[model samples]
Target: MLLRKLVPVFALSLASAGVSADRLKPEDAVEYRQSAFRLMSFQLGVLNPLHRRQAYDDEAFVYRAETLSRLAELALEGFTEDSKGQQSRTQARMWDEREAFETRLREFAETTAQMAERSAAGDSRATRDLFRQTLQSCKSCHDRYRIE
Candidate 1:
């Protein structure tokens, strides 16, 4: 399929770009971050019902968790100084308190990574716990750093 071929090429381009603040436009950063978050939310939303029903599709859950972990890692890169003035839900306080925001982002990335590892290892209980923690981390960060 065209998609199968293009995906690798697209990924190669992104990898070669080694995206940095200087390389990203403000609007592009906003779009990139928003897209990453939306994709992550979609993965979590799927996982949520499965977790609640205690129905584990082992391979699917691992796939979603791995996707979420990758997205979490990519998400923070969108918060460039250039993106501050863009029309977005990101709070000024997030940019103002850069250290704290970065810390929270790091924690989120770590949590998602753990969730993926647990899922892959067939540790359902720990995966569920990490899922809850990941959701809580989103709420906690949103409360402080995102505008409604």
Candidate 2:
């Protein structure tokens, strides 16, 4: 019982040991946020063809969905401080409408997480639907808050 109690405390401490989000330098935050999106894109590439029936890699689909969920979370963390740099596609509106930006990221993460759960259960239909919802969330945010 003591070990079990200690284990919970230890786990919480370990989880909280990650670099504080606000400690990131502006350029580092901007670069990491963009990199997180790229990672999500690569993971999506793994799922898309299989999802479209061009491939039958069910295991890859599940793995990619799980990865995308984590990537969404990472993206959220990276965007914690709106540090749009010279090379960033993020719009000034992101900081201007900060709460809305956060809402979009949260929705994306939630939907992607649902997709991951459905993919793990081998439910292609639900996975595909949730995947679309997650992408729609991305597109909606990009439309409003990203620049080409």
Candidate 3:
């Protein structure tokens, strides 16, 4: 019985490891960009509804904040390398604006972290403010780096 349970668990772990080992190639840039954009949009969608509420579940806020942080990190990573095609949505000035993009990404991450911390501390007002600021950073970066 123990062996049976252990075998299935081991197989599942191996399967997941194999799936994760498939690195993103330049050919996959479009899909990766879309996926990352969707994640950011989803996180912001959640925050939009919560802005009017005075109090929100701390755990929920933290979860969303973490998601935003991860999305920002992924956005930075996605732009690190070149795509296979010449018609990418990435801006032509990305190479020149690299430093500015990195700064904005870091600011988004820091603001999201602050939001998480404030939410955990039960500071709704601060959390809301930080969330808005983080959203603005995301918008600014997208406006400059993202073609659409």
Candidate 4:
């Protein structure tokens, strides 16, 4: 009887844990842009901590890089759709810039993945260079597409 009671309690806790792990999706353009921005912030938060000499992990570095890349791509994606609002900062020209933005994001992701591989192989210099390149891409996209 005690075992059966414990099983249900354990299963309920596990189910709740999974629900808590689920991320909330943004429902509008403004919220989507802000979500993208927050994702980039999170990537930046993880980068230095995961990439430093004493704190490096190839898997973690790759994960953060991939996350940053996805956020950049999503930022552009949010702009491509019509934002049914009068106060959107998304320029009409963003549709034209979409392809280029996607290319840059892909390149950034690939470079960072390479950096992770190099880090795994113990190449510190390559890792640093790749990290800089990744940051540059983020800045370039934000400069062109995002408005305060």
Best prediction by TM-score: 1
Put down candidate 2 lDDT per residue, 1-120, tens digits, no spaces.
122332222211212667577877777887787898999989877777776883322767766776777677677777755465445787888878888887777667667766766776
Per-model TM-score, in order, reads 0.82, 0.79, 0.74, 0.59
Stretches off by above 4 angstroms in model 4 are 1-30, 49-59, 73-76, 84-92
Identify the superior model by lDDT, candidate 1 or candidate 2: 1
* lDDT score of residue 60 within candidate 2: 71
Q: Lowest summed-lDDT stretch of 10 residues in model 2?
A: 6-15
Error of 3 at 20 (Å): 14
Better of 2 and 4 by lDDT: 2
Candidate with better TM-score, 3 vs 4: 3
Tell me the deviation in Å of residue 51 in model 2.
Answer: 1.5
Q: How many backbone clashes does candidate 3 have?
A: 0
Candidate 4 is scored at a TM of 0.59
Give lDDT for model 2: 0.71
Ranking by lDDT: 1, 2, 3, 4
lDDT of 4 by residue, 22-96 (tens): 232334655775687688788878887765654444556755765665565455444434443435655545557
Overlapping backbone residue pairs in candidate 4 total: 0
- For candidate 2, the per-residue lDDT at 100 reads 80
